[model samples]
Target chain A: MTTLCCGGCSWPIPVESWNREEGVRCPVCGEKIVALVFPAIARARSGAQPEGLVSETEASCFYHPGSRAVVPCDECGRFLCSLCEIEIDGRRLCPKCFENSLASNRLEAAETQRTMYDTIALALATFPLLLFWPAIIGAPAALYTVVRRWRAPLSILPRTRIRFYLAALFAAAELAGAGFILRAILRLPRVQ
Target chain B: MAKNKSIYRKLTPRRRGIGGFSQLWLASDHILLVRSSRFVEQYRRFALADIQAIVVTPLADHTPWQLAALGASIVWTLVFLVVDSTAGKIFFGATGAIAIGFSMADIALGRRCRCYLHTAVTRELLTPVSRLRSARAFLERIRPAIEAAQGTLSFDQIAAIAPAVTATPADAPPEVPQAPGYLPEALFGLFLVNAVFVLLMQRFPNELDNVLPTTFFGEFVILIFALARRGVRDPRRLVYALMVIALLFMSWDAVGLARSFTHYMGSVMEQSRRGRPAPPSLTGWVAFEHAPAVLAAGWRMVAGVAGLVAAWFERPVKTA
Candidate 1:
């Protein structure tokens, strides 16, 4: 039997093992306790072949040609041994492919940071309305923003194009209003 | 399921006095306290991991204040009846009924003592184990469970582990329970009552000569009791200090009530001798003898403001 520690406080729990269904309380911190059950890490030496390497007639590891190849890399199609093969999401990959895929995000394992143009466009078109003086400058800036990022990728989740449309409409309205104001200002001296 | 059943255990409550209306159920991860009274049935859960401390304080006895309020209200009703004022009768009767109702609530809802499950963010009342003996028993049953749940780690070790896990907001640990807003509620009620009493005193001085002190003293006792209850429920230094200040103010007012009344009567007699028409009905008398009623009002304002500040500091739990 292995000793169970609290998830909250890491206090040594006296219980034999955690029950999967419900959680317990940490006597020390009083946090709700749930056990994280994982297999013990193996202490065996790395790259130690269980059996003798295959001869020239049989398949050999791409990285270690003297060792036998167990699986092929899913991405690069290179032969890999037990030590050289990295398993992720049920797919085996060679060390170089694994390292490269993670670094370059070729595997699409995670999403990178992206600019949210729709948000920027919306902010440009609306925030300037607070200080009426900036509306003249903001109208053109908002218009330019929408046009530049029109074809850019949106958020990872599903969303409609309503925000883009709204931004464009507001920007157009501001520009028209600015024109109307300019025309009215020019006519004011003649009327007086 | 069998393993689940084995993990789930029942906590032995220290006290069992809700006429068998309260129960404690312990699952692998949480302890649930189910309390059912005639008016309400409340279920409270304490996560095993989040519990920082468990404490039981001595049971509260609200009898002295409850009886005081009851007596004063009854007296006020009699005085109103003797005066044959229909509005006065109704008003005083309502006050008396309210006082009785609160007393009854105190009897039904008030526990002998307070037992609480403490965490960093919240202090939860354990109604079942309110008695000293029962709370002890409850502690006995839950101690091993908590120790077992936690295994072994010091407070510092837990603190060190918290930052490592907060890299992803999605993976962030659950928010701790918030403190219940009972203290604020109590403080607000006390302040409101004081305000109303002050307004009434300003409007009707002669009629409320006896009434004001009686009701003020009565309400003071009740509010003090409420403050004491809150202190026991959640021990905080600020709350304790506020309670002490309120007590001192109340004592000062109680002692001065007799002298103020005597002075008021003396002034009224002197005005009669001089053949003055009498004080204006438009506004209550501001000065009662040599001592100004403004002094008493000032004291009340101080206390009310203090209560408000205390209430402000006592934050309630957020519910989503």
Candidate 2:
């Protein structure tokens, strides 16, 4: 069962993976995290807590302060609010952890791979040129495109990796064909 | 993306290489295994599943048999059929079998396969201090029985020697792994091979009732050793009878050309190899016959190295 969201990585965790009796771990950072098993009834109550009835922390975000908590990361047992929320593969995340995951990912991945958005944009800009050339620049560029596509892990999710390669192929081909025509008129051998 | 990080924080009350004495600690629900003192109040192995974490400590690498089993096992199924719990039982119970550990198998190889199964096994292990003592006692108790079992075809010994001839795939199994390392890996190999055969025979195109020869025999042998050691527990003659039954079952295959083709292939490879071919007298030895046993014996020591390598290069496949 999807037990709760982790306070650190903000990923959904199964009950078996967690320890409510003792602090469990943040699956991402491998840090000890308290798993507060809040009662459903208390969670259902949505008004300002009575003074002295709840401590300041009880009212504040368990993971982050200065930000009121509307909910907690189900896995790590950290409190979170809308601002701190991030969604990954259908799970919610705190802003800090979400950014951390992204940052860590960036650090983990080499500079060759930018961001998902960048890859997609690069692929998009390069598409539409495939028709112009089939060899020379086009052939080489298309090969790069395919390699890039292959490098990006393929999945059901809309991963732009494949598209980027295709786009590169198209762009390279278009540029090559255009250059071929210019070369032919400009007293240069046409590159096949 | 937002995984629970707490799982990775510390060891539970039990360390990864927990030996025999650690059993009481690990088996008991009250006991927790943590990695470090700083993590005492934080997270423990008990909650490892919550964060999809794996518990690995140094001494645990001493438990290498399963790791080698994993690498050798890739020839067939994507999932290494054998898991830690079953592998543990075999290693702890058996006298000296060890195998490789594939972190890929532990963590679902490439990464996409993060089902609940992975963490369950990696989460806890009884301590070695307890294990080594139990091992000594077990050997002494079973010495006579094991010696007897060692007679005849001596399945365990033959199994150990098989990889020497098996010709590991492109990533061939390492050469003559150090002691304790090879045993677990082979057992793990058996586990993985067992899992694969189960999938192939049961989950694939066949009917569920069809029992796999590998699992059927592997389990029976385990029982035989157990019963032989006990002698007085349950009737062990039944196990002996089952051995005959298994011998026949393992030999049951297609007739004529199909059998001849397989037999010939085995014979062709058997000649002039590092390992002696399965004895012609032994009718039941198939190619996969020693898959598990050999793998268990070969990689147990280096399973840690395999795991670390896997961790470095392994990208989990994202399963929907």
Candidate 3:
């Protein structure tokens, strides 16, 4: 069983202080805290144990030879005992397949972070305009980034491609500005 | 992405901070905290069934901003009254009105707070529900969804079950050594000193050359030290955040000063090349540059006082 702790000081909150509507002051930090105790807090977790084969005719688990197989792993289609089967996102997978899916980022539910290339492209296109000189390099870099990462998987959250469009527009303008500067320099009078 | 869009509903308003924007989203079985810094999106999910508590601690930090705004308004109004020129009077009066408006708006928003969500595995701060009023509303809104997922336990049932589970001595958290508190105190003290220097510079513009550089240098050095000393588990997180904001403000001030100096120097050089008499010194020219310096000083003083109060409250309780 796990005990509830004060968020402020991480001190064990007294049982009497739990589920108070008005809240209670943490004895350690003197900060007011409200604890919502759910039924799950009291519910004990039961660990799955592999069942032993009653007879030699019973199919044995792929990982555990002595244990009776309960189900097949969704990914690898190997027989797994109850103890070896891991359920994640409604799919029961073997330990090896679970590790593989997590490592390869094949499971969407397992993803914790993503690099937002659109934001990077937008930042590059806009922020460099402050210095003016960096725009020469920033513009091309931003353009390259947009083109390269165009097909890349976007944020898990719904996001628009407006950033890419804006980046391309700004980069084009910067390149035009640079070209204009070059043309102006070409048109300048030569020194004797 | 489309599947996620359909499944996850926005649970809280996006709160923008120096690091990035953070927002809460409700999934079928979990609540997700998404922190998106421009180039990266980080996710933290807490399953509804596992959530043990949602604690909201009242904060008085918002008062400092209100006080600072009110103080600035009063100062600007006084300047408006004193200035003889119509343009000066109008500008100062408008600035005063804007400051007063900001103070009023802040007051109307209700008391500020920090909300913390507790699960079996982790405790996370929910930044979106940062006001006491909003925290209550947010709790009420999410209660049904949470109840549906985990089922409800009455107060009596919770009280009955708590002692049996919590009585074990092994559940007690190990005593950890407290982090040193001097860094925040020193940083806040420096903020007050720097504020005083800014006010003094405004009062005696002729001394700006000596005072400004010293103040800026000392500020950066102390700020860097304070930031470096910050530990991951340090309880004075709000103070560190304030220090970061102050650093950003100071950096902006430095950039503004450099730009002004560059422009002044360029003008002086142009005058010299044209064989005309040079303009007055930079100090004399910028003597009446009142707004930014005054506002900076006002906010710094407010932050200094507020940070000191917070630090005092956060000091470890001694036991016999």
Candidate 4:
């Protein structure tokens, strides 16, 4: 049986509550919840059925010897049956190649995380001024970070290099201020 | 970076939470939920073809925050009227205006809500689409993408596919015992105790120095426990609301304490520079610092009473 659970409380909403333009109150949590069911829910899922090779002349699958090959893997060019063919991002790949692409982050659809180095550089440049002493260390560190990660891939979403520019400016100013302080300290009379 | 340009479009505005900020992005074949906490950004993608349903539940949760803001505005306005100094008057008046502004903005924005996306294997809450209007707009915006992937089903078709059936008595599951409300009760009890401690401090200023801090510490610990527990199981709305208010008040108190310490340290340095005796203990100085202590105490007392009353009326539910 197909079940649609209430969002508020994980209780399975009765079929009576389905397809209502106006929402129905969840019996368990009493929260008014509206469900927009799609045709996919009603559609039956079909699994792949690989046919056995009729003759020895037929091309056999790399993984399954008895199964006839339908297509070649996009990455490694290995013969694959319908069951072994995995399609993602307009590319048909075998199971091993698909897993490899995901592990290497070559497939954008499979990427699950990205480090935002620009935000880190900006934070390093600015957040240390609160204590007023760590800027001496933070300034060079921020500059180094920006220089090292300037060409690094940013968020998958569109973002500009404004943060990197801002960090560089702040780091330069901090370094200049530190230089002045160092000069002043050196110029001061030594007390024995 | 060039490879990903124009590949994903933003579907919703970024929403900030205690853990991080999250935003939704619409990809060609899937929708992505990106959560950025400091330097790292995590992503969860749901394919358009696999989505079974999108459920939206309108939440009346904003009332607590609105009430809190209104209460804060009144308290600050009262402080503004009672204070004689011009600086105090200006600060209190500005704070009052800001609080009222927040309350008005919250009302004008519309109702708050939560949107959940369901698939065959996973059910996930869409965090960025928390407002009712945004949730609707989000549904509308993604409808085309979903339709392109999975053809639409008419109401008649859906009804025919999932025919209505009256539930039989034998099909019903047995009633399960309700979980104990010890965490919320403890949290509310600590709020009451903290309010009493504040009142006692007003009476015998120096007597309960260590006791007040201990109570505050204990309250924070219990509040954290309640918040973490609520994540696993459903709790009463009032209890969650009270916990949020308590967290906000505690954060404000911590900032006030920090400011007081800085001011006290500056005063000590100035006095020592002039060859004069330093001031008294930091705890004593903080206790006497200019803040809305009485207002905070009153709010704590009110919240504690409300929470206890709500907990008293909590009804149990049976699981299927």
Best by DockQ: 4
Q: Which digits, one per residue and each the tens of the lDDT, describe model 4 over residues A1-192?
A: 347777666677766676576888877767888888887787666668999999999999999999999999999999999999998889999999999998887887677899989899999999997788999888899999999999887887888888889999999999999899999999999999
lDDT of 4 by residue, B225-319 (tens): 77766743554677788788878988787666566656777788898899998765655454534245676587789889988887777634545
List model 1 lDDT by residue over B1-320, tens digit each.
Answer: 11111333567533345443566768666786656442233446566766655544443356776677767666755655654568877787787777767666555544455555655456566666654455556766776677676554444543444443323223334545636446544554565566566566666765655556566766666666666466334634565566567667666766576555456656777887999866654233332332435555665666667667765665454577
Question: If the candidates were sorted by their lDDT against the true structure, best first, what order would they fall in?
Answer: 4, 3, 1, 2
TM-score of each: 0.36, 0.21, 0.66, 0.71
| Candidate 3, B57-172: lDDT as tens digits | 76644576577668868887778886778999999999888888878767887887778787666668898887778788788877788899888888788767755755433454
- List the per-model TM-score of the A chain: 0.63, 0.31, 0.87, 0.87
Instruction: Tell me the deviation in Å of residue B280 in model 2.
Output: 31
lDDT of 2 by residue, B1-320 (tens): 22222212111223243221121112111123323221121112332112222221111222243444555444223323432366654544342222223334343322111112122124233232123233333223322332232222233533443343322223223333222122222333444444455345322423321344445456446534543343222222332343334334333422222454466556756663757655443333233324432332233223324433433343233344
Model 2 agreement with the true structure over A1-192: per-residue lDDT tens digits: 113444333344433333243445544445444332211101222334322214554556644565567766644657675555544444666666566666665322111122343244343444333343334454454555455545443221122344554556565655566777888889966699
Better of 1 and 2 by DockQ: 2
On lDDT, the candidate that comes out on top is 4
Clashing pairs in 4: none
Question: Docking category for candidate 3?
Answer: acceptable
How well does candidate 4 score on lDDT at residue B60?
Answer: 50
Per model, the share of native interface contacts recovered reads 0.00, 0.00, 0.52, 0.62
lDDT of 1 by residue, A1-192 (tens): 233444334455433223322445455555444342211111122344524475678788888877788888998899888878876645888878778876764542232333567777877899899999898888788889889988765533334556677889999999999899989998786654
